[model samples]
Target: MVIYVFDGSFEGFLTAIYESYYNKEKPDKIVAMDDYVENLIDRPIFIETDEIKSDKVYAGIKNKISTNALKKVYHVFLSEVMEAPTVIYHYLRLGFKIGNKVDLNLMDDWVLRMDKINQQVASEKHRMLGLLRFQLVENDLYYAPLAPDHNIIALMANHFAQRMSDQKWMIHDTKRCIAVVYDLKEWIITPIDLPAPPVGKEEYLYQQLWKEYYQSIAIKERRNPRLQKRCMPVRYWSFLTEKK
Candidate 1:
């Protein structure tokens, strides 16, 4: 049995496929590099990700599986869960077994597990979309900082680019050490060393006006702090426009 150990990354997962194909060996199990246990495997192949290898397997998977399957796998990867790599391997294994028909619901434990994790990742991505706010910097580039539970940075980029297009914007994923930048022409996923924008007098006034508008809408008699906290937790409110 060939144990394929890959870097703990989506690209690394793809690169493993390339190695499996090039080596002409079916992998007994494909696991994250950190998850591989040295348990007297008959054969073990540790694949370090190379861009060429990554792209090769990526293209192969795209050609072999329909776009929908590729998308599902991507969503699963976004979770960044320790179990996600194993789940993805099972999904891919099933895909090889049933071809495109593997996508259908079945009384399968692995499938259900992957589906549930995917749902959680999707939900987090959507929540971050509504919660994220930007701060305009000196160069007119808008920047926002967020620490999401999942790697939703890539998933949320499309929504913001369309909603805030024509404005140069940057949404930094603090935990991941990456950011998505949307320039007038297009969006580019990049790394970050964010510098704060110069605090201009007009910017301060705008912030004050925003705060005033939020305050004006408050009704002391009807306010329920506990109920409000349930919807948007206090921990997440610090960066919100209306929250201090």
Candidate 2:
């Protein structure tokens, strides 16, 4: 009963998969960075993974398995789920074992679990895309901060890239301490530094106007805090334009 332990990162998990199949040992168990096997009886393998060479593992999936299957594999990782590395490894193992064709049917335990994880992450991303309100900072960069339950920051990139393409902006996931930056030319993930000092009058005016429009559009007499809460939960109000 060989067990494999990996850091709780997509690349780390990929390294585990590479190790899991790359070696003749055929490890019997797999788990994330923090998870520990309860009843350990066999040789244990622990891997401190690197993202660079792990691209080879990812390439194997895209090259060996169909490219479309790669999408399913990534969704499982992007899920930001507990014990996600275990689930992704299970999915990949099945993919390789099944060879030519791979079907992700909900009836299967692993498939169902991955599907549920995808839904959870996707839901959070969609909600945050609209709920997120940015602060216009010095040098005309829009900065919005959020702490999502899932790793939906990557998921939110394209949505904002398309919507705010013409503008220079940044979306900061405070929870992760990383940010998605769009500088009108292109979009890339970046690390956050500090409080982006306020941009002069123009930016402040836009946010102020947006806030005013938000307040003005609401019909006070028909306001229902309960209904609004149900629609846009209070958890996201910190950066919601209307809520603020």
lDDT of 2 at 5: 76
Tens-place lDDT per residue, model 2, 33-122, is 566655646677888797766898888888877787787678767775666667767777777877436554557787677667767776
Give candidate 1 misplaced runs (Cα > 4 Å): 1-4, 18-45, 50-53, 218-222
Provide the clashing-pair count of each candidate structure: 0, 0
Q: Tens digits of per-residue lDDT for model 1 on 85-192?
A: 768777776776677777685678888887888898988787888889787666787878888888888898889888888889888887778998888877888888
TM-scores for candidates 1 onward, in order: 0.81, 0.81
User: Which 10-residue span in candidate 2 carries the lowest summed lDDT?
Assistant: 99-108
**Per-residue lDDT value at 230 in model 2:** 89
Q: What are the Cα lDDT values of the candidates?
A: 0.79, 0.76
lDDT comparing candidate 1 with the true structure: 0.79
